[model samples]
Target: MEDILRQAVGVLRSMWRFRWWGLALTWVVGAAAAVVIYTMPDRYESTARVYVDTQSVLRPLMSGLAVQPNLDQQIAILSRTLITRPNVEKLINMADLNLEVTSGPQREQLVGELMSGLRIGGTGRDNLFTLAYRDGDPKRAQRVVQALMSLFVESGLVSKRQDTDTARRFIEEQIRNYEEKLTAAENRLKDFRLRNMALLDAGGRDYVGQLAAVSAQLEQARLELREAINSRDATQRQLQGEDPVLLPQMPNAAGVSIPEIDGRIDAMRKTLDALLQRYTESHPDVIGTRRVIEDLEAQKLKEIEMRREAGPGQFGSLNANPVYQQLKLVLSETEARIASLQARVGSHEARLAELRASAELLPKIDAELAQLNRDYDVHKRNYETLVQRRESANISVEMGATSGIAEFRVIDPPSLPLKPAAPNRALLMLAASVAAIGAGAALTFLISQLRPSFADGRSLREVTGLPVLGTVSLLGDPRREASERRGRYAFAGGVAGYAGAVAVVTAALKMLQG
Candidate 1:
């Protein structure tokens, strides 16, 4: 510790020995540094505070019905994009910045400078954001901050409105496309039904039920025909042993009565006879009635021959016996029913064949129909979702126009700053003082090293590695001492002049700042 102290004392003494030079250099360097610092441009800062109000009076009413933008995210984005090239250019024009460059690169550099000077920050865990700008001019700094605030608010509204419009247009386009698809699907379903109309069971009766009904009717017809043939043969056998004139009358079958047919034939003959009485045989009504009577007579004769063949009996005037005629009528009716049932059976068979063929196509048709239905359902769901979203978008647009939700409000407007924020004068002066002192000390040390003089016996012993003898004192010369005194005065005068010059520069700087 003592050694360190002694070394420090030695350095101080050496500095003091060259005190005039040290003082002159210290004042000159300090004054020069102070002037340079004062000449630097002062930067004024202006700031504005913006509050994001995400609460609205209509929010409760439109909670689920309107699109709500993320306020924090939007604010974050605005903070980043607020100082873009276009916005910066607008700020420069509005504030009339003192940039005189006309070239694109120079303009870009100016914009970059503006951006670098701009600062945007958000308060912790709050909806408040701050916009700050620094510039040489206080008013220009305020104007820049004001412009940024306006851009932040306006850009948010514009972006929201544009998004709503785009959403509505996209939904409308999707709805139109789905509508066409739905129409086509409906038409295909209709055509499919129409094309397979015969194969489809309108009454919901399955194929098995239809086939059973037709077979049952066919079997009943066959039973009735068999009964009628047996009755006809019995009647024919009974007629062979009896006289034709004395044959007994018989009751008509349930569904067939010879008497009724005979009455119809008689009525037609009488009508024809009456027509012949009124007009010539070649008259239209007369010819038509005669043709009808002839057709009935021919039908009766055919029936008689059918009965005779059915029994294998000799029939003499079989039509004259009412029993045989009745049996023959029943036989003819049964045969007609059998023929009708056979035709119906054939039709049923064709229908069954058609059903089988349609059944073969059912799986493929069902698969296709299912796919169409699935597509229709998907499109329908999507269309509905789009419609819902479109409604929300419309509501959001209306809410944006009427409400303050997701909006920025400038709580504190930018003000003209009175003091410079940058080029801290006091700190710069202090640093200059430190640097000047360091420089003076360095020059003193350098001069001492160049002179190569020993300060004490210890330094001499260190240099020569020899023991020191008693020190010698030299007598002073008056003339030399007088010259040294004059040199001291000159050194003092030079230091005073340098100090006065520094004071003058400082006073001028203060006047310029004022």
Candidate 2:
């Protein structure tokens, strides 16, 4: 450790023997660094902060249970939109940024530089954002910020107005279509009713009762007519030349009593009983029995003739022939009348069925058409209302700027900075100092490596590794030594250069302080 320390001290001492050169270089470098820093132009910076909070207009559409839009995403979108070419150009035009001297690649370079200076960033957890720009003038930065904010508001409102107009137009078109359909349906129903005229008034129990009564009267008339015709035919038959029936007497000892063969046999039996009681079988009374039987048989042939003469009242009760004949004639007429009435009833029933079927369907169709018409009207009204609002929106008065609470608010406007943010003077000077120290150390190392000759005995011995056999001393007088120091060119020049470097450093320090 001691040896290492001794070696380090010796090296430092050897290096410091050329300390004058290091001092001169330090002065020269420091002066140059100060001069460059002083000549550089001053730059100005402006910073603005904005808070982007949530607003209803920018909020996402949602149902009761739906998730809301992410505020961070919305802010990101707004930021990107603001940085677009149109927005940037608008701000440039509105603010009248002084870029007249800038042209071609230089102008483009300036714009790029400006873009780099303009910072847009937001905090992750907070809604606050920072916007900053650096320029030669501070007021231009403030104007740019104001213009951008105004343009953003205008663009958003315009988008909303367009959407509203589209919605109104779509609704109106749909309403018109529905109205046409409703009108057609109503017209069809009216036409159907007009064509089937009778169906409208034909209904209720009166029509049914009348139809039944007519049928009953007709039936009774048909029954009476039939009986009258039967009576008239029977009378005609009796008047014709037909053989008279003979009565069958009770069987005597000589003749068989065939009552079925003789229709008048009962009449003959009564006569025979009267005769047999007055005389014996051989008596003249028996001959009178045969005559009486024959007379009864002849009378039986005219019974239908007698029935015809009885007229409308001769028969007993309901069975009287004259009354029955009259009743039968009335009955036949009633039956014919009933046949006509029955046909009418059938016709009425068919018409009623047709009318009923038509009536049943008409109401259902009418009801459906009515509902359609109502819906069409409601939609039409809504469409008209929207159209009016949209038309109003197109006017300047309606599109006028509105001042309200906003999601994004500017906290600080941009302003120009007095000093250039680039090319830091302090850093440049520090670098220059470091470079001077390095050069000084490098020169010393080079001289050491070159093994330069020194007047000192130990160094001369160390370099050549040869013995110094003798030493020469006091060869010159005092006056000559003094003259040598004054006239020596190498020593005089090196000292002058060192003094000039020191004077330059002192002047630079004074200028920097001023």
In order, the Cα lDDT scores of the candidates are 0.70, 0.52
TM-score of 2: 0.38
Candidate 1 structure quality by residue, lDDT tens digits, 110-219: 88998888888887457788989888889878988888888778887787677778888988898898888778877876787688565545553445554566466556
lDDT of 1 at 385: 86
Which candidate number would show the highest lDDT if scored against the true structure?
A: 1
* TM-score of each candidate structure, all chains considered together: 0.54, 0.38
Checking candidate 1 for backbone clashes, the offending pairs are none
**Model 2 per-residue lDDT tens digits across residues 43-62:** 55566677665555412332
